[model samples]
Target: MLIDVAIEKVKGLISFFEGYRETGFLEALQIAKEIALEMNIDATFRKRRKIKRKKQFDENPDDTNIAPQSAQESFRVNYFIRVVDQAISSLTRRFEQYEGYQKIFGFLFTSETLRSLDKDSLKSSCVNLEASLTKDKQSDIDANELFVELKSLQNFMPKENIGPVEILNFLKRHDCFPNASIAYRVLLTIPVTVALAERSFSKLKLLKSYMRTTMTQQRLNDLATIALESEVLEKIDYEDIIEDFISKNTARMRMFK
Candidate 1:
């Protein structure tokens, strides 16, 4: 989708340049400058209007002095644009952390990198990983050892079967290349979204309402974990749990026997 938008933007720019060329340089410059100035003025007006509308809404949130639907529609469009802009800005900021990780992962999984397994390419991957971990001050691994392990692993594993899990398993099986394995593990642990955290919060709310206000943190965590992994829980045999429960109590064990 981003590619499509970029293509269209490029096409628009081409058309713009062609039109300007046909109209002569000086005329085109004047026209372009005027358009830019007008756009800047319009943007300023829109910003002011948005602020004014927000202030009005804050003053009277009850919809008592609601504007006409046509006016409201314009406000909605402005509101939507503001929201989208803010959301994109927030997402871009969050993605900055993963940008280095992305480059490292790309290098790790690439056919060329795997086939070559040279010191230079491996060093570049290490640099990319280190940049991603800028918050941490120390680089713990031996670079030469990591390179050797990567080359050995690449030779052992087929290109067709290479993936995140496969690479992790290969590292585990060999029990070498602690640094490279740690990097892969860290990459695997990175959350793709906040949805899981949000879901846990939602579950907490449901589990520890006013009735259950005295629940301990440990118990709440246990319950929440169970709630989240309900699919796994569903597969368990309740009869086995019952037997285990009975065995834990001597009286119940005697009764069952």
Candidate 2:
């Protein structure tokens, strides 16, 4: 789906480039890179094949003897390469999009409400996003204004660049200015990733040598979820969340507990 959209974007820009030389060339190149990166072509195929082959070999010692473990090592290397390629591509696309958005949308989010950003500032936000994804917590940087700005732009024209005060006024008159408050609330509001807890348990291995890798997968999962969600989860009753989830996913109470 993302690929299709990117392809269309490229196609759309093809003719539009006639009037724009360097700028168009650069933007089009970027779009092409993003489209290529977002295309996770090998994930499904490689994962399935790896699982299937492992299962088949497990079921038949004779078959495993035929291929040798060396062949499996080759597969592992190839899978690793694909993973690295995908990660690099993903990072490139993210940084590009963050930069692109800043070029197009930063005007709407200047001042302390949003940090005054240069190109480096946009790059800094991307770094923060990556650290947050990997560490699963907010980075020290001020990104709330930028985040709120992105959310607000969801409905606005991407190609347009209006002033910051104009945007604030639009939101204020329309009762969206209070988003500033909401954005502040979300800085540490949710468990967007499990990496934080994962890192913590990984630290546990340091203190307990016998349990270096002894933690079961299920136990690890539970630990990570609890660590990340503990603060917010403790504050709110589960019943309310269950009710909200049920309300969103079902039409009637009979479908929920």
Candidate 3:
């Protein structure tokens, strides 16, 4: 997906989540309560029924004070709020990281973003990217080389605005601009959302249990990839897989036959 589309999607999800948490959840909870009442079950949370004692003069009142809250209100505050807040926090962190990527690769992401940059700003962005990619005296692309390549590229760009995918395509067809091509390829690799990655992690938790702590990194990665991409696995013909396996394992194939 395009960066702009990804940004919009992230914003939309955040807004929808916040709206649901603020109002929609409570509305749904009220319906649930009604249903519970109809079934003759307790709708509200169990009371704490705390036994209070007189405070000593040595203790500060603020240290021991607990605000009296209704059972339902207490449940919402202690349980629901904490759960939703964790989700919101994770979203906020991912959004912030995405924004940082946009800042570094923003100009290269689209023709509009690229065109808006002047010579100096464009050079500055390239330098920032070069620094980010640099580690232990190694770098992916030279900032000076990239800036020069982009300037040449701008002259050949079409009147219609285009995104990184199109720019990569053009570079591939021409087979020129080595630095610019590298930059675009790296930009395209950035994830639009963390959903798929996080989902894989959830699968990974189940696959790599405490009992299986001895799994190698490569093996674990392979297992996780297979688990997450099960739909692709389902689409494959079993006959073709059997044939591939047979070809690879000649001794086993002869024994089976």
Candidate 4:
């Protein structure tokens, strides 16, 4: 159920972005802020309810584990309230850092404005993009020329075709605008959740059971990696792997012969 809620929240964020793709960054930011506000309100309500229930639970000493109904209700309320609090905290942190994201990816997200941006606006965006880059990456390209190339590409490309992937493909195809491509690549690599890490820990528990308590960390990591990527591993040809193994080792070849 928590996963479902998380998925729904992601979906909401995607939908919000999609709807505001052609609009400017300000519009998108407003939508996001509204969504976050709604979530905050819901979280505040849940927190208050949790506090009231906790107070009730504390006030009646006899009610503490005396009745399964009261105890179960308390546990359920506490666990759910914790989940809500976590979700709220995550959203709040994202909101706090939103301005930086807007500065970096704002132009990429606003497809409609890309082609129409005048020299001053494009220059400002270029400065913002360069400011966001690391010192090593910052020195490697001319932001002004990259902005010129971006404007030229935007002139030829349809507004609808202007997106992160489309722009990336355009840059790669033309071998132009290295800085812009790198910025987009950085944006693409940013993770939205810790679900993958959580899954890894879960896999670790399964692989390193009580009986396997003495397993080395290196061996456990290898096993967990294999387990996590089993879908990809399943597609590999084990027969080919065995043949290659035999070809690489004289002992294996002799044994097989």
TM-score, per-candidate, Cα-based: 0.51, 0.21, 0.67, 0.48
* Predicted candidate 4 versus true structure: per-residue lDDT over 1-257, tens digit per residue: 12223445655655554444334344534565688798874322222232324446347676555533454345335754455456556665655455456556667653565776787888888777776674955454457876877777677666574556666776777675777677667655554467777998889889999999899989988999899999999999999988998999899899999
Which of the predicted structures, 1 or 3, would earn the higher TM-score when compared with the native?
3
Choose 2 or 4, whichever is better by TM-score. Answer: 4
Model 1: how far residue 187 lies from native, Å: 0.7
Question: Predictions ranked by TM-score, top down?
Answer: 3, 1, 4, 2
lDDT per residue for candidate 3 within 124-235, as digits (tens), equals: 9999999988999999999999999888888788868988999899999887789899889988987786787899779989999999999999999999888988999899
Model 1 lDDT, residue 52, Cα? 45
- Candidate 4's C-alpha lDDT? 0.65
Q: Give the TM-score of candidate 2.
A: 0.21
- Name the 10 consecutive residues with the lowest summed lDDT in model 4: 43-52
Considering summed lDDT, which 10 consecutive residues are worst modelled in model 1?
A: 42-51
The digit string of per-residue lDDT tens for model 1 on 12-31 reads 55455445434444454456
Model 2 lowest lDDT segment of ten: 41-50
Model 4, residue 40: C-alpha shift (Å): 34
- What shift in Å separates residue 93 of candidate 1 from its native position after superposition? 3.3
The candidate that wins on TM-score is 3
Q: Which residue pairs clash in candidate 1?
A: none
